[model samples]
Target: MLAAMAATEQQNRTWSQIDVPDQSGRVVVITGANTGIGYHTAAVLAYSGAHVVLAVRNLEKGNEALSRIVAAAGHGAREVHVTLQALDLTSLDSVRAAADALRNAYSGIDLLINNAGVMLTPKQVTADGFELQFGTNHLGHFALTGLLLDRLLPVRGSRVVTVSSLGHRMRAGIHFDDLQWERRYDRAAAYGQSKLANLLFTYELQRRLAAADASTIAAAAHPGGSNTELMRNLPAIVRPVATLLGPVLFQSAAMGALPTLRAATDPAVEGGQYYGPDGFMEQRGHPKLVRSSAQSHDEDLQRRLWTVSEELTGVRFGV
Candidate 1:
């Protein structure tokens, strides 16, 4: 019984709590920064003095977020510069183009936040014919991360933070042969698979970085239950259920971002750590370390996924 309790406690403290000093000279790229938790994260980072690049799908929405950030920053707005860049995760071409533009503009990226994702979205195909959720949430970020890895590695203390979710636990596992679900499609199942992939990628990338003796750190975070636009596509039937119990089960967007913010800025954070809210059901609260399933740490699946992603995107990341 004591051993069981100790094991549980150890899992809970995977990421230490420590203050992250100012990020005056840091450059950060965040996806889906137009609204919800993404916007709050960008705003907070900008307020804290990081040069934030908002990688949004809609230019107009991106501009709005920039304005909001500027307004929120007040006189210190000069310390935080928000650059709006177009990034449609569903399109490989768009991802490649945005990466190119970012590389041309910034010599090194201190942080890359793979935050943009769709949740419980309707079954649809992306521009490259991949499932929408998998395309945007997993493959898109994979390609972008690989593309920007060189710039990231050059920086002395760079980090790539990938946002995942508790939905991952619902996934059976990655269906490697039929990743796109050509034969069938289940919205929640697909979303869960993608979230699980995010964790696997985070762990696998950390391993790869260790092997290459790189200075960069790779980590993952889940917002708990932040009630973001991620659930916009949930079937109408589910919204009523969510509304009836959302307050009891979900946290505000600002609170939802704490785990992510912690992962990005915490000085004590190391590669492969995962963070989430420390609440009764992980539905909301302060940032704390979290545990993922044994499947998420599988080395074989990570390698296979990385290889397949490069082939599908036609853009190698190590470049």
Candidate 2:
């Protein structure tokens, strides 16, 4: 009877911020951490006692976020180091420079959270002449990970957590022939492709790390339907309705960051795993181990995407 009671309690347990283990002495680098889900993720990690680097495109905003994180974490018993590193995920040049700077600054890194990304925007291209969403969300993070994987390889319990999205399942697939969408473009489809790429990158990276017999693991997560600044790009006609239904349609950014935090810090998390909310349609709730689209798990497609990403970014992964 006692065992049954304990089992019931365990099954009913709700994982919250309190479940986040001590992160002291660990180093965390989060991109696009100046706002929204990234900011919240950084804040939680900083509070839990990790040295965090906010890699953002806007140094000014990054500084502001750093200050906010420090302020929120407070100077209670221990001090958390929070710094800013300028990184523009849309440009390979910026990604390379940021990676070099980070590599020079830290002898080892515990976590690299590829959380920066763009949403549905009108037809646009990155500085590297690639689709805006695909280049910034997928190629940029891919390059950064390859550049920094060595530093994390030797660090026990190190993780590369890339933030993907449920949108990965929405009209998303690898369009090899039209990688850049030069033939045609749909904002939603393009965003879906980028999110799907994030998962593909994470899985492929995990496979490589495993093949190399490395301890560092790669994981992926999604924010669910959080009402973050990313929603600003919602079609104008739907904006008003979305605003009216915001309370029902979206959860807070702090809540959105939970799945990512869990994936990054949860010791039980394994390589090639994906996490997201536990609510309806995996939309909003506490973090839970989740499954990504079937297409995302295709090994051939993942390998092909890796090759294409390497060709486009000119960055190679030693793993």
Candidate 3:
């Protein structure tokens, strides 16, 4: 029992940027690829010879990121093929349209990285009328995955990798009764709940895929304290302090993206596993397989959330 109860230790084995396998001939779609961790993830994979689709809400910014990624790839840029797709996670219509566009463009997608998110924002609703954090972070990705699952299903070893966060460790769980927080609001708590939802979605997805005997798998990863624009919504009072401490507390966006890259491409990865940094408190270091909160592993909760998500988005997976 004690052995079973022990926290999963960081593997002594190391994984780094160079460890990512050649992605030649692979097709990857990464949301929020215009900047920060998403941009870095797209860049690295492009450098490794994957055709990366930069899914962003803003085409102008997406084009800029494409240029930057191509330039960063240097001579490898000739081998890199990166394109831009407009994806607004705040809107279901946009999610559907983007998925349709991707389907028309690619016969198979090797990886779909649900990496876009909003954090710690003031109370607001998405274009779909759901609370912003929960809507954009969870439901949007849920719908996107469902719409794209068919494309992934036929591809051997294809994966849907959702980028969750260490923030999920906060006092959080699925607020089933108050999912939208229509009665009350706490930005931090809402953010925690959304991140938690990311895990639940991944676990439930993997289960359904397995039960259906599908080749596609679901996994998740966290950036773990990367200094990025995602923090723009931090409370005004806390912003200055975070800014001052950011340099000391955060890793580069490139390093922060390692866990995601591993989760997306690692040959050893299994469905439903979560990956994050191996450093203290699971922050600021190389990627390693990590554990999530017990709530995240609750199969009943996962199924319930999956059902609620399908109801809300009106999108059902083929699995």
Best by TM-score: 2
Best of the two (2, 3) by lDDT: 3
Q: List candidate 3 stretches off by more than 4 Å.
A: 1-11, 76-78
Can you give the lDDT of residue 215 in candidate 2? 92
Each model's TM-score, in the order given? 0.92, 0.95, 0.95
Q: Tens digit of lDDT per residue, candidate 2, span 1-319?
A: 9977864563346666777899999999999999999999999998889999999999998998888877776556478789999999988899999999999999999999999999998999999999999999999999999999889999998999999998999899889999899999989999999999999999999999999999999999999999888998998999999889878769999999999998999776789988888888888898888888889999999999999999999989998
Q: How far is candidate 1 from the true structure (C-alpha RMSD, Å)?
A: 4.0
What lDDT tens digits, residue by residue, belong to model 3 across residues 118-150?
999899999989999999999999999999999
Q: What is the number of residue pairs that collide in model 3?
A: 0
Sort every candidate by lDDT, greatest first.
3, 2, 1
Q: Rate the local accuracy (lDDT) of all candidates.
A: 0.87, 0.91, 0.92
Q: Is candidate 1 or candidate 2 better by lDDT?
A: 2
Q: Which candidate comes out best when scored by lDDT?
A: 3
Per residue, candidate 1 scores C-alpha lDDT tens digits across 62-138 of: 99889988987777345677899999999999999999999999999999999999988777999999999899999
Worst 10 residues of 3 by lDDT: 3-12
What is candidate 1's TM-score against the reference? 0.92
RMSD of each candidate? 4.0, 2.5, 3.6
